[model samples]
Target: MSAIDDLADQLARDALDAAARLGDDRLIDDISKAIGASSPVSQEAFVSAVRIRQALARGRAVMDSRLTQAASQKAGPEKSGG
Candidate 1:
């Protein structure tokens, strides 16, 4: 795979892992709060929270990918990098 594709795939896997670790219930709660309010201000806040969460997920994925790659490199040539 190209380096960019590899990186993306690795990132996706990491995000999935983090999501699993954090548990779905918490995520659901956060999403619910972000989208559940009535007032315009509250709705705006919710939207912002949703955006923040999305960004965080992306960050987590990137971090996970980097860590996986680092670990594989440390393990030597027999192992593949993420």
Candidate 2:
């Protein structure tokens, strides 16, 4: 990747990590806005990377949830004393 592309990717990753740590999901958007104001050239790439990562995270969560539910079902229901 070119320098700008590499930088954008790193910024996207760092922004996501920061957001997770700070418990503010808007951090990505805030970073994107800052980049747009200062370095418009890399803003698109950064935002794209952020979106791709978020989508991947969501997909993984869905897969994990489905597998967990399936396993619980296969294990059968719990029993209780009368």
Q: Which ten residues in a row have the lowest lDDT in candidate 2?
A: 73-82
- Model 1: lDDT equals 0.58
* Clash tally, candidates in order: 0, 0
lDDT of each: 0.58, 0.90
* TM-score, structure 1 vs. true: 0.48
Q: Estimate each model's TM-score.
A: 0.48, 0.77
Clashing pairs in 1: none
Native-to-model Cα distance after best TM-score fit, residue 58 in candidate 1, in Å: 0.2
> Which candidate ranks first by TM-score, i.e. highest?
2
Quote the positional error of residue 74 for candidate 2 in Å. Answer: 2.0
lDDT of 1 by residue, 26-80 (tens): 6544544554554444444444444566789799999999999999898886755
